[model samples]
Target: MEQNDGLWQALDAMAGEATEYFQKARLLQERMAGITGTAVTDDGYIKVTWRDGGIDGLEINPRAMRMGSADLAETILRLSHEARADSRRQSDAVMSDLFGTQNPAGIVADKEGLQESIDMMRDVFTGAIGDSKDLIDRLQRRLRQD
Candidate 1:
């Protein structure tokens, strides 16, 4: 009975430690909410400003506006996705700068595929769809044969 009691006490202590850690992380996140990062498309036609949650603003080039609405919309969609990816990359860089080698609590996990989750979350957090690099590659190659 004593051994069981001790085990439960230890578990309770660990849980308390975890809770404290999470609280500190939340504080850190709150403190970081105001900082912003800018991500421009590779072509410089679109620029997106983002923070912890989603895009704060978007700017489209006049050249982009010349296209028909459907074409402009598609291009905008693609650029938005790219901007979001760049935002995530920027966010990771900032977080790494802030946290060093330690993974930020609630932002990432210490397991395989966690990086992928981080990448996905970055896009989700920015409210953008992730690029289909594979599809782009295939289309690029197929269309180039003409």
Candidate 2:
């Protein structure tokens, strides 16, 4: 009976820890969704905003038209790249806040880390189940001896 109680306590504690991790993950998702990144050309003729990993807004100053079409296209493309980079930086910041580590690869790598944590928890639960089975077997043996 004492062993069963201890096993239940351990399982409850693990469940609580898993719940906390899931809550933190959800909060991080909300924060990342709200993040936006903006960039402007060096000459301030082109501006772009990135959200959810794509260009969400753009602004081209009237002065930008004075440049040759090729130059204007190049500037816009460069600004777009810069905006995407800015978005990556923002995502990394959010990931760092959630995971205590910063990497530019963004959420893909973090998902792997999250999976690993879940795997660890699964192992813990598996071990707990094995321990419970062993305890039950021991108790049955004692009962048989009596």
How well is each residue in 1-146 modelled by candidate 1, as lDDT tens digits?
45445555655785896787687577557656655657665677777776666777889888767769997677666656666676667666656765666556434566556787777657643432213344466679989997
* Most TM-score-accurate candidate: 2
- Which clashing pairs does model 2 show? none
What lDDT does candidate 1 reach at residue 105? 40
- For each candidate, the alpha-carbon lDDT, in order, equals 0.64, 0.82
For all predicted structures, in order, the TM-scores are 0.45, 0.73
Off by over 4 Å in 2: 1-6, 101-122, 135-146
Candidate 2 Cα deviation (angstroms), residue 85: 1.3
The lowest-lDDT stretch of 10 consecutive residues in candidate 2 is: 100-109
Instruction: Flag clash pairs in model 1.
Output: none
